[model samples]
Every structure is written in structure tokens, then in C-alpha cells.
Target: MWPGGTVRDVAGLWDVALPAEAVRVPGVSMAGFRSRTDRFVDMQVVPYPALTLFVDFGDGRVVDDAGSRWMDSGVVGLAPGGARGRGRSIDCLQVRISPLVAHAVFGAGAEFSGAMVSLEELWGREAVRTRERMWEAGSWQERFAVAREMLLRGQSEGPAVDPEVAHAWRQMVRQQGRVRVAGLAEETGWSRKRLWSRFRSQVGLTPKRAAQLVRFDHAAHRLAAGEQSASVAATSGYVDQSHLHREVRAFTGVTPNAVAQAQWLDVDDVAWGRGRAGARRLRVG
Candidate 1:
């Protein structure tokens, strides 16, 4: 019963399965999804802390609002974290890739910020070959295995992010995005300028922006869970309710109330259980 009934609460029209050990890959997590209804569904992707990869196994199409190529079987989509887009009738295995792992697997970290590109564009013909295997897999578990192997291979061969940058990223996540950039620079033994440059180039976002995105993500979930806006603001590190309002509107293009009632948030409760993929932050060794 959203205002004016303009927003349809269709979060229940899909089944979401968390990844099991067979498909487990560090720096990433999987959420398998299958549509229960054939009707067209509107997708409002919230800003997340990890880049997303979508492997469509079903016959339905996923069309984005930005006039990007339509997504279907035989193709996969890669959207950077904090990016927003819409899809329709999506029946896909969505994987959230942590930036720490995205660099090793995808290599082009800076290019992914707020960007969306097809795997074919990023990985070339290999993308086609991989999608073929995923499409041919007899079950979701099999598909997950294929994906896990592919990621493992890429991760093994790809370059690693700088250890200091990795540590800074982890500290932000550990602190729930309340950590200061200057303190992170100090702890990493790098000058503030150097830290900012390296972090931006490797992680695809400046330290402050990354922290804000993470903070906004945490606050958004709290709002969805029926917390008062003012309380969420105070507890989540914002200046006040007004600060929270501005941040929510900046990230989601909606009012605090609208984000609270977002159907997308509602799905997290069911689609993502206790071991929410990418819920655990990465650590620097």
C-alpha cells in the first residue's frame, strides 16, 4: 500500500537463493534468482558497496533505462557499485563483486565506477564462451560452479590492488564508513595526496565518496527496516535528519520515505539471509 499505488510491491514474485560452498569465491558472493511470475517487473537497483555481475539464465529480457543493450541469455552485465539501473523480468544469477576482487578479476577498476557494460565488451569473445557454458549448465549449482571456476582463474592471473589501499577500504567497511580519510592515510604510511590518488585509481572512487556510498547504503537499509529517519541519521553518522535526507536523495533520487518503502530493499530480507553475499568486508593481509 504505497502512496498512490504508483509503486508495485513485487518483491515476492521472485525466488532468491544464497550461494553455497560449491560456488563460494572470496571477494565475491552469489545470489541466484528465478522469477515466479511472467509479468514485466520494474527493477530499481540501489547503490551497493560492490560491483555487480548478472548472468541471465531465463528467457525474459532485462532492458535498462539508459538504452544500453538488452540483457538476456548468452550475455552478462557488469554494473559498478553505487550505480543505478532498471531491468525488466529478470531471471538471472546476480553476483556482487567486491572492489578488492574486482581489480583482480576485471582489472579495470577505475572504469567501473557508476558504469555499466556488457561482459562481452569487457572480456571479449571469452564472455560469449563463458555464457554458453553457463547457459548449458543443467542446474543453478552447476552454473555457479562454472562461474566460480572462471572467477578463480581470472583472480589468479590478475593484478592485486595495493595493500595499503586494500587496508584503507577494509577499515572504512569495518567502521561502517565512519572512518576519516586522513586517519586512513596516516595508518597506511602514505601522504594524503598519494593515498587519495591511489585509492581513486584502484578503487574507482575517492575515499570520501566511497565512505559516503557505504554510509548511505547502511542508512538506506535501516530506513527500509522501519527505523525513524531522524534516528537513522543520528546513529548512522550523518549530521542530522536533513543530512540523511540529502544523502538519500543524492544516492537514490528519491525522498527518505520513498527509499524506505522501496520494493528492492524488501527483497534483501528474503533473497539475502544471514550470510548476505558481500556482507562481510574484505581484509588486507
Candidate 2:
């Protein structure tokens, strides 16, 4: 029998399924989602630090604010401005790939920087084939397995980012985005100029932007978890609660209080294993 799944209701509208077993891939995590009542879902896509891939297998139609519609799959890059997902009867596997792994798994990192692209554009016909295979799977476990195999294959075949760049990224994440760019460059033995250029080309965001995104993500989740904004800002490396408010507005076009109530973040602990205690262990190397 397939392992029993853990389900959580998001605002009583969607049922989220978390994998019973941890995905073994480094720098990757996934969650399966399905609508509960055939009601149309108009979900705000909160920007996060990683590259995201959404594979739809249900009979529903999914479209974004940018006017792109897809029944199969699409990729969301870092900091996609004001992206919202709209659809009915939706069922999909959402995968979040750390930019470090994305560099190898997707090959052309710069192309995805702050952009949304259909999977067809990135993987060509293989995108269709993979979606079909997942659609044919008997259970979420099977679908997750199929997706994992596809990512492993891509990682093996695609080019990798420079190790120095990878190290710098890991540092930023480890420090919760508090590490300085100059310090990272010194640690990587790359000059500041070389590090900035190479990191942007490979990771799809400048080190400073990536750090800001990471810090913002951490703060957003805390806000969602009901922490006081002032406390979060103080501990999350912000100058003040007002600074937190501004950063939240910059990223989501909303205030921190508004972000705290966003439905999209309601499932983070279950779906992404990001709880107040800590995050699920990710394979950094």
C-alpha cells in the first residue's frame, strides 16, 4: 500500500498533500494540491526564494495574471511580480528547486530570471511527455516519483554552476541572508565584480537581490505564523518594523499585515517543511 498522506486544508478551499516520505534530492521539495469543492481558485502566488515548477494533471485549466494559460506545466522564476494563479478543479504537483540545483537542472539560469515560462519552452516535447507520464500515475507517490526521476535526469545532463558561486549562495542561505556580498566574495576567493557577474548569470539574481529575497521569505513566513512584525523585523535583519513593511510591499505589493494573512502561505509548514523551528534538511552539495 502507498504510505498514507498528510492533508491540510488551506482556508477551507484547497486540500494540500504532503509526501509521506522525504524527497531525497538535494535542494528540492514538492507538494501536491487539489481543490476541495470545484470552486474556482484565484490564488495569489507569493514570491519565494526558489525557482518553482507547477505540473497540472487534473482536467482543470490554469492561467496566470500574465495571460499565459497551461493545462500541463509552467515555471515561475524568482520574484515574479504580482503573479496570481486562477483555475477550477485544480490538481497539481508544485516543486520548489533551490537556485543552486536549478542551475544544473534547468541549464539556462539567466533566461528564467524574474520571468515566467511555459515548460514547453524550456523542455520542448519532453515537457509534454513528462506531464503525460505523471498524469497516468496511480497516486501522488507515483507522480512524485516520476517528477523526481525527470529532475535527476535533468541534473545529470545539464551544466552546473561554478562551485564558488554555489558556495556563496549556500552561505547566504545558511546565514538567513545576513551575510554580506563582500564577505562572500572573500570566502569564495572571487573578486566582488567577478562574483556579482557570475552569480547573476548562473543563479538568475544578483547576490544582493537574492539575499533580499531570502530574507524577505523568512520574514514573510514568520508574519504568516502570527509573529509580531516588529519582532520579526528585529530578528530577520531589518532596520525596523517599517523596514519590514517596505520590503513586504516591494515584494508582494502589499503591507506586512496583509502578507501575514495571505492564503498562499498557509500551507508552508506542511507543504514545504518550513516551520517555526527550522526547515527540512536540504542537500546543499
Candidate 3:
């Protein structure tokens, strides 16, 4: 809502650390989004063997998967294979990946093309399903341990850079309150044009847009916890109330209050937030 658009009163997205060792994320959300009224926008229903990463791809209006680029707002997303009054809307663990991490694990040049293939291979279907099963079987601690071993401390590695972009980005999340494209380019010594090209080839969105998404996510996190608009805006780094509304509408497609009332998001929730999909083999010096 700040400089871009659609700020809400309160919004929230959830993340659960599944048992790392063996887990199978059931398609509980698919069942919940049965009616057309519950449909979300600009998302890809990327399914894994056990659990699925409900990534908020973008305003289905802008990103044209078929066209392979951004388009119009009238369009949004394709419906999943199933979703009736049976259960709940799709949800996910608010996870994210960085360009540096992918380059380090998959191989430097892999990021030039989509890095998702290698990630899918790294966290294979069987392993993914196993992780899900483990989650359903244990306490939160047990689930976290499994996830830590399997994901956090497993084969995952850092990105390839003198100064890790992933580390820098996490800082950006904390300090800048947004991942500014121009700033990243300046820090990396890449021209804005070069930066955008490389970023799109790898992460999907350009830098400024990605930063906005990250910012929106921060606000959504606060809102999800039942915070008020004024506090949410301040904590999330928004300038004020109007800014919040603008940002929320552009991203969440709902207001802060509405988002507070709602608990889950489907394909469009995080909108290309954390579902960029790239993990590399552990690389050492």
C-alpha cells in the first residue's frame, strides 16, 4: 500500500514447520476452496508428493504463465483439480528462498534458467511425503526437529557470492523494511537493467516488486496475529493508514480487517512470496 497499491487493515498467512524427516502435507486446503466465491488469484497450484507450497504467485492479473510474463489484471489464476465444501482453503509455511542459496547448491549457471527442477529433485516426492507423515505423527518439537534435519541442516547450502545475497536479504527484511531493487544492484555493482534481467530469469519478479511483496508479507504477519491497523502499519514500516490500505488491496485482495477475519489464503495469498522454488547442494569453500 505504500508506493505500490492495496493496503489492508489486517492480514495473515501461516507457516508450520513440518517434521523434517518424513512428512506428507495433505491437500486439506483444496477441499476448503470448494466454491467459486473462495477462489484466489494469480497463483500456481504447485503440488508436491505429500505437502504443497501454496505460494502467492502474484496478481494472476499480471503474471501470465501461459505467456511467460506479466499481463493484465483481468486475469488471475487457474482453479485446482478439486475444492468443494469438504474442508479448508489452501495454506502454507511462510517459507522463502534466495538467489544466492540456489546458485551455491544447484550450480552457478542453474539460476539462469528456472531452478525449480533441481529443488524438486533435492526434496523428492518420497521424501516430501515422508516429511508430511512425520508431521501428522508427532508433537511440534518432534516435527520441527524432523524439519530441521531434513530441510534446515540437510543438503541445503548458501548462495554463491562474496557477500551472500540471502544473508543480505534477510537483513533487508529486518532493516530496509523492503528489498529495494536499486539498492541491491548498487550493493552488487550490477546496473538496474542487468539486475532486473537476472532477477526475472531466476526469481520471477523484478526487485522492487519482490521487495513490495516481502513488505506486504511483514504486514500480513502482524495482522494475522490480530493487531490493529495503526500498530500494524507502524510495525510493518508503512507510512500510515492509507498506505496500508493501498498495499493490502494490491496484494491480499482484502482489507486488514477482512484479512484478520480470514485465516487462510489460497494460490494468491503470498503471490510469488516464498514459492520461488530453488535449493542447491551444500557447497563448501
Candidate 4:
């Protein structure tokens, strides 16, 4: 049986929040999931895109899963699209930060670079955890304000990405052009070796590598929604279909077609070999 309260909220780079009605998974209660999804989740399972911070009342854990390659976090489970419901979950907010947002905050080199470390460590660790309960027992709006303050201050000033490199990254995405690590170095006015150094430290991966992952991320989403791989390449801007396959395989360790069938992740076995993003606890009983 589904629960009564279910709200899904999505946030984009605009800072404009979009709210969706919550879903109370029928037949199952949050009690059922208090074991798995609720445990402390700090394992890097597979590869995908996106870093997820989960706050589950059923238990208490933070899960980071990317569709292609997850954050540099260690392995815990499978894919990110897990379906286990939160029994009677209250309304909560989820924000999917775009690469641009990460770039804006962390600078060009570190945004969506596949590899990841705590944001604090990169900039010298002067930041506090944004989600610590401050007022305790208050409206969600009040809690949001406290978190926003910390987030805003964290990005006030410090190490930042070079504007030219940042601009080049976006242009490449817009054009769907080939990813060339050496060329990206020229675009950013840094030697290839130098670029990789800053890029890895700041963003967690090299520029070319990160861009390809981001591109593959979009393609996976499209394919899951029924867009064919060759077609996915055309829309996302690949020179040829095989190019898309290699890029996806390098990042995700799987081919494009495999990901489509692998889209429906469960609590246990996953389709593709995605480490973290492949595990989802669904309501099977």
C-alpha cells in the first residue's frame, strides 16, 4: 500500500524551485526501509552522473550516486534510481546542481569532474555542513534559510576557475564537439599537464574527461526515456555513434544500450555495472 504523504521537489540552476506532490508508496511503511536506505551510505558503488545527498527519516544516511560515474565516494550499492519508498515520508526538497552551478561555485576545473572530494577540503575546509539542524522543530522554510546562508557564504570568495576555461567548457557542451584534452589546455591558456593538475585538484578530474562524462550523463537520461543511442549521439553532438559508445563505456564501464535496460534499478541487482548509482531499494513486497 502507498503512503499518504509524498512530495518530490527539483531545483535547477535558476535557484527557482519546482515542487512536486509527494508519493506515499502504497502497502509499505517507512518502517520497512529503516534497514537499507536509511543506513549511513558512504560507499562508491558504480559510475553515473550527479551527487545525491539523501536525508531519510526512516533511517539516517547520505547516498551519492551518479548515473554514469558517481562521485569519488566509495562503493555502497548500485545505481541512483532506487525505488524503495519512505513509508510515510514528509515533504522534502532535492536539488540537482548543474555542472554550471558547480563551476560557478567551485570554478571551471572542479565542476562535474567525475572524481569528487569534500568541497571544504578543496578550498581549505572553512565551511560548515549546510544541513545541520539549527532551530530544530520548525517550518521547512525556516530550515531552508539557515542552510542557504551557509551555502552562500561558502562561495563568497576563494580559489575559482579561470573564466576562459569555464567559457570554453560551456561552448563545447553547446556545440557537442569532440573532446580533446590538449586542445582544452590551449583553450584555457594552460599547458596540458598544468590544466590536468588544477582540473583534478579543483574539479576532481581533467577537463576533457569531465566533459565527456557530462555529455554521457545527458545521453543516458535521453536513452532511458527511449531515445536511441545513435539518435542520442546526434542530438547530443557526437561525430559518430561509436564515439558515444566509447565515451560512455570509459566513464560508466558499460555500453549505451546496456544502460537503457539497466535503467530500472532495484534494491539488489542492477542492470549495468554502475557502482553507487545502481542500487535502489524498491517496494517489492
lDDT assessment of candidate 4: 0.43
Name the candidate that leads on TM-score.
2
Per-residue lDDT tens digits for candidate 3, residues 1-285, read 011212221122222222222332221111101112234422322211112222221222223233344321111111111111111232222222343433433333323332123223445674556446543633433433343344443325534444434443454556644556677778778777876666544434445654665676666655655578899888777889889988776655557776544323332333322221221111111
Look at candidate 2 and tell me the lDDT of residue 257.
Answer: 89
Roughly what TM-score does model 1 have, to 2 decimal places?
Answer: 0.85
* lDDT tens per residue, model 2, 111-139: 68867788888889999898888878877
Per-candidate TM-score against the hidden true structure: 0.85, 0.89, 0.46, 0.54
Encode model 4's per-residue lDDT on 1-285: one tens digit a residue. 112222121111011122112321111111112232222332222343333222332322333333333222111211223222222222223323334334444453443344334434444433334433522525434433443443445346545556655565565565543477777778778888877776655544556666665676667666655578889888886878998898766655677877654522222122222223434333222
| Ten-residue region with minimum lDDT total, candidate 4 | 7-16
Error of 3 at 155 (Å): 3.7
Name the lDDT value of residue 126 in candidate 4: 36
User: Distance (Å) between predicted and true CA of 238, model 2?
Assistant: 0.9
Q: Flag regions of model 3 displaced more than 4 Å.
A: 1-125, 128-146, 152-164, 202-204, 225-227, 234-240, 264-285
